[model samples]
Target: MNALVDVSFFPRAAKPLASYRKFWAARFGTAPFLPMSREEMNQLGWDSCDVVLVTGDAYVDHPSFGMAVIGRMLEAQGFRVGIIAQPDWQSAEPFKALGKPNLFWGVTAGNMDSMINRYTADRKIRTDDAYTPGDIGGKRPDRAALVYSQRCREAFKDVPIILGGIEGSLRRIAHYDYWSDKVRRSIVVDAKCDLLLYGNAERAIVEIAHRLSRREPIEHITDVRGTAFVRRSDDDTRLGWFEIDSTDVDAPGTVESHINPYQTTSEQAAGQGTTCSKEDQTVRPEPVEGQAEASTSSARTDAGSGSKPLRFMPNPALPQRVGKQVLPPRERTVIRLPSYEQVKS
Candidate 1:
């Protein structure tokens, strides 16, 4: 009924979630649940879905299921969405059931990582999958995100693929894979998906769907938070990093008990009563670099000299309270890690 909305519609401080105008499909009202097959879609009198979500879990209409949450969320935003859950990955026929989406294909490995779902913590094959309808195992393949992305590409070669869910997000970059017993390259690079949305992607996904509906290219939608994309080899994206040492962070200065430890029970009991004695004291370590002075809040110090820890009572919250914490700027942070080439060698 109204014009479409973009990121700049709302104030910088306010969330633009519900601010976007609803898609024209809002007039179609809601389906009983997101259609799982073309028959269901035909019954709803829909020629094609706006966005089709390909997932490795059964399509439960509950919020607890990742695909359901995403599907309903987009539906609420007025987009005609469909689901292709746990489809037979052997052929692209299942993927084409809902037909090609007008916006893009959202692919996820469901709630849990496929490898974790198919195997136990010890890397033994698992016999059960709680997410599956039958409470059985092997509904989805190992590295389900990669497999599903490839299939989506096969079904609709011109459509953009958006890789998501725990399976893909966890492996966004070169990381160790327990099942394969080795490190693997970034899932986006391997899947060749246009974008990868990580973490709680409600906001990110909503924006992406709307942008795609407006015919914005997914590759150029890189500035959206929570989304990651592979860069062209010619692109010069500079990276910077600063290290935070655990030891340097605020901590209970090391304990140097002035009292003897190998004492008799009688001697220890006697020492407990004399809490005010100066001989029964602890000392503070030198201040951490950049810290103007050592923390004295947890210990009593002599007024005359530098921090002379009279007694040490650790304050667990010291780390949060003392440091000049600097959060990396959003949309510009770059993590530095060893290249897969070096790590493999």
Candidate 2:
């Protein structure tokens, strides 16, 4: 999470989320709640929203509901934000209900990944949706971020589409799709979204919104930390970061392997150093790193030049507590993960 990391696409925010100049709409004050319908938008004396968030959960104006906090934050920043919650995905008319947004369409799959929310870890269909108002099932499509983004694009072809939330954030890169049993390309590519914001977009959203409001092109706003977008091989980004290719970061050690999918439930639990099995859990967890990634905190790695293996000091508890930290060149550096083509092959 960029909020936790000291470096990335950029360092942690030096500026506060609210410190930015408010948008022109901030003079209207915060809405009773983010407008969800044309009637509500009219009631708020608004013709168009600055940002419209499409979510798969019922509109709840509590801080516990993430979208609520985001809406209020934007409102505090003088942007009129609207919510399109759990709309009928069969058509694009519902998406057009809020009319076109003045800035961009923000899309999410709600509190949980759509596939996990609608199905059990064992891959069985679920009969109820916790996020749905009535606890009714099938309120969202299997891949809600993709569906909502596509529908938003259909509703307003010219408006930029930005995807966030756990679903889009986790899938921002090529990763194993346990549901599909294949490596899927980044969600930005699959959704054809102009940008994908990952891991706590508090800083990224505020910056991007302000820039877009000033008529800056979304395609040119690639420097925002924790956001991902596509670029052709020949595109001259002129980015000033050092990208370390990490494809060879680790050797194929004897112990490196995915846990046996066919193992007894008990065996799987023991291997994970947990007494409880993850299989068929009653409550699904918020998204986290995949279970398949190898742990490197204590693992010795011989940097790929035939040198002796060495253990890296585990990361500090807090990024700010850089107590006795060593130095590397001040060049902004990031790990260049395997390409989508490399992953698929």
Candidate 3:
């Protein structure tokens, strides 16, 4: 009679059969489709929503890896993150997967400008190129930037859009590009994102998550570290615009005004001569001392002099290019100069 009785388990008490099937797949030859279980996803502690991180580069898990670092950082901060790798930007599926992100994260290749040029040039000239597979031919001049913006606008309305990475940074100003053969201004304006965190955005991203977690209104939260935002200049209405320290240092000025030519004034810059400061998340330019200044006279000149000081711009070659620039003496003043104390502090 006891054998005739049916065994019953509560919904919450029993492990779902799906979990067992996934485990079986893991044990067998098949790669488990979902790497983590539902319980694991819940344990990751996402705030009931996800942060969609769209990247321009291929995805991998390495310490110095930009997307990996940011993704790990976001998860550590209690946000759910879904990565869309090398998105076509032309397709809607990438953005459609996660529904909508609480925050939109972007990253570009170290050679974003060159990469886009190559991608576009390839598309324009190639007739039998089977690499794109099903991709249609009409590529735009600003293909990467436009596709990112359009998808975000279509999929996630009202959510704050943040733009970073190479595609956005080098294009942050009205400058000429060799590949596209055109001049453009800040990507933020063109892409219509609420904010753009240019340069190396790791630390800045963490602070941004912290702020958002606190429920502090995004607009009132000023002086964010390690990032740049566009706003009206103090005097000029239209053309007079630049980057200001998003912290307590409330003065507004041009993009050149906020650049730290020395990069940072902290101990981090001591050995590698790299500087990053928590005081202001913005990175300063590296200091040129001794033999480093060979053939570069602009290093010693005062900003007040008629001649330009050195300024560091992006160099796709260096890992730090995204972090700092090496400017001529005249352009050096375009970004701020960091004091020795600032570097140490």
lDDT of each: 0.78, 0.80, 0.48
Candidates sorted on lDDT, descending: 2, 1, 3
Q: C-alpha displacement of 31 in model 2, angstroms? A: 1.1
In candidate 2, which residue pairs get closer than 3 Å at backbone N, Cα or C atoms, i.e. clash? 26-78
lDDT of 3: 0.48
Off by over 4 Å in 3: 1-48, 104-111, 114-142, 232-345
- List all candidate RMSDs to the true structure: 12.7, 17.8, 22.2
| Residues 2-119, model 1: lDDT tens digits | 1111121122242478998899999889889899888999998899999999999988999889999889989999999999989999999989998889999999999999988888
Model 1 segments more than 4 A misplaced? 1-14, 235-337
Query: What TM-score, to 2 decimals, does candidate 3 have?
Result: 0.48
Would you give me the overall lDDT of model 1? 0.78
lDDT of 3 at 149: 67
Give the runs in model 2 whose Cα sits over 4 Å from its true position.
Answer: 1-9, 238-242, 248-334
Of the candidates shown, which would achieve the greatest TM-score relative to the real structure? 2
Q: Higher lDDT: candidate 2 or 3?
A: 2
Q: How do the residues 1-345 of candidate 3 rate in per-residue lDDT, one tens digit apiece? A: 000000111122422222221211122222212112234334543332445666544456555546667776565555566665556566666666555565554444322542444455544543221222244322322446556666767776667666677676666554565555555445555676656666766656666665665566555434454344444333232232222222313333235444457654564355455546565456667766864675365555543376775886654553332333433333111232232233334
Score candidate 2 by TM-score against the native.
0.73
- lDDT per residue (tens digit) for residues 1-345 in model 2: 111111344555457875798888878887787899999999999989999999988889998787888888888899999999999989899999899999999889998999999999999999998888889998999999999999998899999998899998788888999998999877877898888888888878888899999999986886677777776544555355455556533423234567787898777877887656456545777545654234442243434446765765543552332344443344455566777788899
